[model samples]
Target: MSLLFLLVAWSATVLSCALLCRAALAAARALPPAPEAAGDIAPDPAAADRHASGLTLYEMAYLSGGPHRLADVVLVLMAQKRRLLLADTGWATVVDPVGTDAVERAALTAIGPEGQRHIPAVRDALVGDAAVRRVADRLETQGLAQPAAVRPGIGGAVRLVKGSALVTLLSAVATYWTAAPGADSGQVLIWFTVPQILTLGLWAVARFELHPYSDWATVAGERRLPATTGSRDAPDAPGTPPGSLITLALRGPTALTDPSLRAALHSSGA
Candidate 1:
């Protein structure tokens, strides 16, 4: 290939690779941290009461599940506490406007003008409500729902890599243009590809190892939460009773026939 063509070709590939790598790295680094628990709560053979880590069911749902889960928790709690009603048709009727807590108040507001509406409708309506935000903010303050922030180091590294690639490409272009026609590019592509691939590989390894962010559960919560996986062993924690509120929290609406859970899960549409 002509030296100029080769120079441009290789620089283009290098620039593309650098930009793609930086974009991927930036996305990975920007992932939000998972919702966290106050502490390792009642796991295993301990009594159910022993599992209380100062977090109520609402807190547990928030810590392990996120906003929709919190909404689910509130709905079920309201029904159980006789503050709300869920119809058989997935319609949620607000039984009482006066809620004992902020979350309940949020749900009450979320179910606004509701003689009955599908569960998903309620969730959509509630998405950006101030009361919902307050619950999330409260959880964050309690060390539960940790959000992601822009990372200067990652951003700087991305900029540096991209800048270096652009500068090197510019230098190669200048040399090629200033030289005589028909100069050989030789194996310069190999020189560039090897290091670029290595950088991406290293970055992939680091990204996979660190962060591990999730909106549902923190690293600790992911390990501790009771799962319904059909592993040969028992759940890491104990099982919930068929009709218990915890069953709904851990297993979703189908686990329990509670009208409230069905109403919440369906209404929230999450």
Candidate 2:
């Protein structure tokens, strides 16, 4: 009877946890997009033309939030004529462009055998954006520096697994206590403690997976470009011919951090 009770309790705990995780994920998916700050630059018109011409480049920088500090840069190249969007980042791309630039920059910077080739045109185009400049300035003023690349740590994972084990063990203990003697008074305490421990353990695992990193430097310097009207469709849109190319060279950190620059990258399908 005692063994059966333990088995049942364990099953219930596992089921409950699974349901909780599913619910949490669903809630997260339903969340509204992050609020955009005032004065945020809209996507650039030039990006559309560039995209149509199969000439798009993307660079992204990662910054540490807290507890762990690291940085990375990712780059992506798009070939509009070929209907190909080559992403250097580790993540799988569907249609969404969120965090795509950062991932691409990191991958490009991580290329071991390839020598650094500065593309003046790409840099110049990025520098023309206002948004990128803002972000770069904020990062520099915050004293954030490029972080050395290293393999992710296992400490966080191990701690989480141990915590999960502890929660299961505690739940089992509660079942035994309730069945063995007059322990009804402690049921609430045990239930709350189990959930709390499990929650913390899961949070640790999530943090480890989403480890923070910073980029080496911004690719462009601050510069302003006048907005112009051009093609409205995506550069890679079906049946659209390649457009004329206009390339610029960007230099300095501020250019890369500018908010306008970031917006341009997104508009260009980078």
- Candidate 1 positional error at 182, Å: 32
Q: Could you estimate the TM-score for every candidate?
A: 0.52, 0.23
Task: Tell me, by lDDT, which candidate is best.
Answer: 1
lDDT per residue for candidate 2 within 1-270, as digits (tens), equals 444544544454465456445533443343223323322534433233233322222211222111111111123232222212223322222232223343223323333224232333233334433434444333333223222221122223334444555655665566566674664535444554554566566556544542221123211111011111121122323442232111111111222333443344444333
RMSD of 2: 16.1
Cα miss at 52, model 2 (Å)? 21
Report every candidate's CA lDDT: 0.53, 0.33
Best by TM-score: 1
Clash count for each candidate, listed in order shown: 5, 38
lDDT of 1 by residue, 108-198 (tens): 7777765555666665655566766654555554344444342233434444444555544554555556655675544554454444454
Give the runs in model 2 whose Cα sits over 4 Å from its true position: 1-58, 61-78, 81-178, 181-270
